[model samples]
Target: MQTVPMVKQKVHQTLDTLPPQGLKELSQFLDFLKYKYQAERRTNIVALGGIWQDIPFDVTDEEVRALRRRVTDTLLSKV
Candidate 1:
């Protein structure tokens, strides 16, 4: 298989041969490929964030603090 430098040299040679318009389209295509591979996919997660927001149940700050204190007490007891 061709090494990284060899592959890059080949790409540069190909770029050198393309017309100005072809180079513009290539740049857009490259941007698309990068986004396609690297973009974070948070659609489903963000949708789930509000799924229970409409529910009638709600935990107050005191409830959350009590739970955290219980967890910390347990950990400290073990230590």
Candidate 2:
């Protein structure tokens, strides 16, 4: 029930490239990105450090909620 932009899809596409292990880590990263962007009013450019290198994503508000729902549904269905 939130109004967001449509950049989250781009974030998901970026996420899809990650390995399964990376995907787990990415869930936390996505939450941080969403909070940082929405609360902190950041643009679409987040970085990933360590062996993962630098990963950047451009997420909009709408996409953020949509992707969150999508991921949650997918995960729930699997469980």
Candidate 3:
């Protein structure tokens, strides 16, 4: 069985040889895989809608923007 590094190396080698159209297809496939994986792993947000109803919070637009930037950076770092 191939290890994670071996699989990644094989993927990169294949990607390097793909043409523009092949690369586009690969990108779309990867996006689909990410979406499918996330969908399967996600909780049903609607079912938990009222779980946080007791919490009170208020924030300005600047604070929200900064929080979003920080969260995005953190998530991207994991990739």
lDDT of each: 0.87, 0.80, 0.90
| Pairwise TM-score winner, candidates 1 and 3 | 3
Q: Indicate the TM-score of model 3.
A: 0.56
Q: Candidate 3, 42: how far from true, in Å?
A: 1.0
- lDDT order, best first, reads 3, 1, 2
lDDT of 2 by residue, 38-79 (tens): 977656654667865755456699999999999999999999
Q: Could you give the candidate ranking by TM-score, starting with the highest?
A: 3, 1, 2
The deviation in Å at residue 1 for candidate 2 is 33
Clash pairs, candidate 3, are: none
Candidate 3 accuracy as lDDT: 0.90
- Which candidate has the top score in TM-score? 3
State how far residue 58 of model 2 sits from its true place (Å).
Answer: 36
Candidate 1 colliding pairs: none
Q: Give the TM-score of candidate 2.
A: 0.30
How do the residues 13-60 of candidate 1 rate in per-residue lDDT, one tens digit apiece? 999999999999999999998898777663553332477776655669
Position 65, candidate 3: lDDT: 98
The residue pairs found clashing in candidate 2 are 4-61, 4-62, 5-61, 5-62, 7-60
